[model samples]
Target: MPIIVTPRHNSPEFKEKCVRLVLEEGRTVAEVAKEMQVGRNTLHGWVHQAKVMSEAVNRAVEAAVAEALRAEREESDARAAADRAEIVRLQAELATAREELAKLKGKG
Candidate 1:
């Protein structure tokens, strides 16, 4: 495949589009290359020099956020389980107390 030149290095639309492809598109590099109709090497160069660094940083941030969310959900689940266990324990204690009170009132 021949090399395809994108119009100018500073076109806003062009820069935004390339950034979108690398970051948010979720497509493979080759897929974006084909879709952009540019040579894969050229596009790779554009990405590497331009948006690739930011994209990689954004991915790290996203991963951190997801890990935190998962941990928070697990903690919430643990708290709910503890609450249920405490409720059961209190119910059992109440039942024992009621039985003792009945025996004291001459109820066998």
Candidate 2:
């Protein structure tokens, strides 16, 4: 059996800095990889994460999106409920009117 060991990574801040440089600073992944002495695939993955990963600054943006979706769904549900209520009310009214018409015809 052979034992395997993984290389320890740089600090988070360093990783963040490099990722940000590759992503936000428009640095080429290959260039960053060469600078960091890491594989291009590794640098590309870091840059991709930097671009997509949600951060504290983006928390409000994500929350606003969730709230907007919830509000839109709530509005749709409320409209559907209102339509159902209106249908029931109209049906009951129709039944009552029919009964009254029958009573009037009997009196006539």
Instruction: List candidate 1 segments past 4 Å from native.
Output: 1-48
CA displacement after TM-score superposition, residue 51 of candidate 2 (Å): 6.1
Per residue, candidate 1 scores C-alpha lDDT tens digits across 1-108 of: 665565753476775686578767766768887876766776677777666677789999999999999999999999999999999999999999998998999854
Q: Which candidate is the best by TM-score?
A: 1
Query: Where does candidate 2 stray beyond 4 Å?
Result: 1-21, 24-54
- Local distance difference test, per candidate? 0.79, 0.77
Instruction: Estimate, for each residue in 1-108, the C-alpha lDDT of model 2 and write its tens digit.
Output: 222222434567767767877767888887876676666777678776765665654987889999999999999999999999999999999999999999999999
**Which residue pairs in candidate 1 have backbone atoms (N, alpha carbon, C) closer than 3 angstroms, thus clashing?**
none
